[model samples]
Target: MDDAIQTEPVRQKKQKTAAGGSKAGTAERRGTDVTRVSEVSLSSKRAATAPIAVLLAAAVLLAGCWDSREVNELAVVMAAAIDQADEQNIELSVQVYNPRTAGGGGQVGQMSGGSGGGAGAFVVRSAVGSTMADAMSKLQEKLPRQIFWGHGEVFVIGEAVASKGLREHMDFLLRSPEIRDKADVFIVKGKAKPLLTLPVPLEGNTAQTMGKLADIHLGVQVSIINLTRMLAGSARGAILPLVQLSQSEEKAGDSGKIPFMTGAGVLKNDKLIGYIDVATMRGAMWVRDEIELATVTVTPTRTERGDVTVRLVRSRTKLVPRIEDGKWAITVESEAQGDILQNTTNVDFGNPLLAGRLEQDFNDQIERRMTGAIEKLQKMNADVLGFSQAFHRRYPKEWNKVKDRWDEQFPHVQATAVVKVKIERHGLSSSGAVRPNDEVQAE
Candidate 1:
């Protein structure tokens, strides 16, 4: 009985110890639960505030371009022109797309002259002031809606305005945030306003036609950005496509008048110095490595054959500049591969020997063209052929010495053209389609 009594007390003591451990574990679990709840609450608070912070930041960023106007309140500009109004004033002309005339679908005439039969699809408007900005402000006063320049794709400069200088005009164009840098720029013959007023049968207006032509590389394509870089680069010489109205019976006031790009205008220091004809422009393009593809016609010298034309499939040009004893010289190394477009000669192009002769003739023709271009550029003392760029890239130290006097030294710099042509294809026939009487042979 004594032993049982003692063991019972011991067992009671052990149960008390076990009960204390269970209470301690419960307290630790409750503490853990509280910590988890506090962490979740903190995270939920952060998540709730995140969207507000994002919204605030978005509003701040959107404020930059938030000055938006409805389309109906905008007079969309399709093209623009700058001209010398007089010795003291300048003129700014804009062609605005008329939504009323462009909205309806119908016949060709109806499509051009929409529901109300309004004044075609576009209208030309002009304002005169002492500067481009002033003229633009005055132009805004005349328009019913706010002028929108975001859609403009073409800018034409008149001969008189270009000759005067473009620094002041360019300043405004470059400063305007609404203007696009990729817009095509052109130098038009005579008055720029008249060109804008000319009736165009296709593409809504003359501006569309001009932009399409530039995109196709019809002439020397120079965008606003390109002209800016050329003006600012080591060679302050820029080339722009020259616009000329087509000579046809259709008068300027007629509804079917057309304007086309014929040549390139050369500018030195942002001032128009001279104009390059189509042939010389091609040569300039070759020297500048801008020839995409060209169709060249030449009369074969080996035999008394007729004219043969070739369409260059691919071409590459490299300008090699060398300074020998301070004598600066640049060699134009060009290579071309082409297919015979028209073979009016009696000889078969399949013969390697005859093909060789044709190749030589083609090379000679290209060389002559490039030489003529170089001569003309030298005469003008304009470095629009990338000669300045080439020399500067090759010999930076030397370029710095003559850069100031480049105008005086450019006319004397020696330039030569070396061309190689490979006749890759002779078309389906090796001879002319119309066999000559002398080539007649009995079957």
Candidate 2:
């Protein structure tokens, strides 16, 4: 039995050795297979990325700023002026933003507020050519840097240029992709170039100052798009804010002469026909529903001593077109709310009867202004107030019949003004300070 046990242990040892040899061979085969798979994967990855790498390199080499323009190499036009040079030629003046003036700070900043005509923040460059496009091309040739129109904000037309016609300049402005349609347009009493050269003591440049003035709505405000719509409308009548150099007491040259809105230029058939004074322009604004701020002073019929002034808090106007028995007429319906600003009259606002009378007086004053403006418009035969559009909206068929003869028919169409005013607020004190109880008229 001892011999048998020793022989069995020897056999088991042999079997264990064979099993270890088989396991070692199997592990060796598995390692070889894994190495081969890894080599194939690495080779495939390199092959796949080689073409992409080459394309990227080629793209980098081909990409160069051939068509790009540097900011320093461009002349930025802020404002443009068109003037009648002669019968055969036209002049184009551009206000170029000087790059040198930028970051120099006080030199350009002081330019706006300075009382003398010093080296300005902008440079005015002019060129003459037969047409606007030609003038622009020539102007570009005159400057070393490329002319850029992206920042052009104000367009000023000289009185002579406007009187001649706006079609040529307007067409060029509208077609150019760089020109903004919302740029404010103006008509200067003299040369537009002079207006651009004038030093304004309020804003960065004269263009910005002009833009702010237009925004304040002191007078008639007409943008390129506004003018386009008006001209394209059935009325074909347009108005532009008229600018003139202020006649200051101090003759500090162009620097002292501030550009102020004098009135409005009336355009008919794209030609400037006439102008309306500031008061008349205010009346026109009422008819056109463009009144933003206004102060009205009227003498109450009951009191002949002094005049009462009111500041308009809110005002709205609606043109009601009436067609009856083949006759055309328009009713100017206006509603306004105002606060008593000054009361020179000896009256107590607490009295409803007296307030009613004052309200009536306000209505009468507004009516007179509206009727007077309408009469002037009729006399000029220019329908800048959009009367034609009103009639067309209400009576399309009748308007079409008389649309061609609108200029002739406009004068005959009677316009009636109906104004309604409400004295919403009378000052903190109801009675005047100067007038005592004896003079205070109470109902």
Candidate 3:
């Protein structure tokens, strides 16, 4: 009985081991049965599609252009000038680039040299009409190629044209599909035709040179879109950079060229009412918060006869408007960090008390600039500073009530300015660039 029991247990153990072996063997067999598809097998399928792909490519290549236009057929326009011709007529002058020379980019792109006597980089064509479109149509009649407006880089309006009104002229530009809104706008102190005719000495094209000037941030960077938005909104007025032709020698018919960004042209009701000179334009730029680069020269007191020029690094302006007793007033706060670029006065910057005094002088200088801009705006009743826009955004209800007589009300609005300056570095040295041991004053 004991032997039979022992044998039954041995049989069960052998059966268990056999079942485990069967599972592992079945798995090995399944793995071995699997096979990979060969890459070469795709060759036949590729061969089947080869002719179809070739046929499709041939069909595409054989197709002709639906609208084929030649570059040579277009007259590339670089700049445009508008001026008054007669009481009933307006003059339009276009600077057409001579594409035959200098890779055909300019009579504007192909400048002879630094000298004046040449075909020049562009040729100006003038036409007279009652309207901008009429003038363009008449202008187009004279040219063999169509006026390609896409290449226009600058629009210069004469004092006469600007004085009359920019509304009509701006309408043409805004409605035209061919013209780009990226073009910079400028106001000439005098007639714009002569400015376009003058040969450029520095660049391949004068338009490109003016474009660089507009980007310099010394003056307003007003594009068509910028002006359009300002005019459409409740902004009091818009400002544009004023450009004047400056002769190197001031000789008659000399044409030795230089284009000067003279000042800011103040606009009221889409017409130029007056101009703010470069000195005051700095103040305007301060209020506009557009001072990318500026140098402030401050003379502290009678004892400090010389000027200390602070070259601003990073500057910011904040304008706050408040309604007090149904009256609106703006408080302008400006802050700037700068390094002493020039110190003709022997003010010891190392002395904390002296540095503090110098900083106060800077503050006063900036405050004067802000108030100066505000004063001019008030005098002209032109709100180029957009003070009304601030009031509109903050106090919408008040702006709507005064929107009709905003121009008259704009002149009376009260403004206060506060300026803070920090002179972080005194350039390479701690004191004035020209300093004497005896000339140095005590703190």
Q: Top lDDT: which candidate number? A: 2
Instruction: Report the C-alpha displacement of residue 175, candidate 3, in angstroms.
Output: 2.0
Residues 1-443 of candidate 1: C-alpha lDDT, one tens digit per residue = 99999999999989998999899999999999999999999999999999999999999998777676899999899889998989999989898877776676422222222112244567677889999999999998888899999999999999999999998888888889999988999998788876677656666578788888888775788888889999988779889899887744654444556778788999999999989899999889988888886899999886665888999989999999999997989899999999999977777778787888889999999999999999998898888888888988999999999998888878888998999999998878877777874782211
| Candidate scoring better on TM-score of 1 and 2 | 1
Tell me how candidate 3 scores on lDDT: 0.81
Taking all chains together, each candidate's TM-score versus the true structure is 0.84, 0.81, 0.80
Best-first order by lDDT: 2, 1, 3
lDDT of each: 0.85, 0.86, 0.81
Model 2 over residues 69-164: C-alpha lDDT tens digits? 889999899999999999888999888887666567536633422112235577788889999999999998878899988899999999999889
- 83, model 2: CA deviation in Å? 0.3
- Which runs in model 2 stand beyond 4 Å of their true positions? 1-70, 109-118
Show model 3 residue runs off by greater than 4 Å: 1-68, 103-118, 250-252
In angstroms, the error of model 3 at 258 is 2.2
Looking at model 1, report the run of 10 residues with the lowest lDDT sum.
108-117
Q: Which lDDT value does model 2 have at 344?
A: 86
Best by TM-score: 1
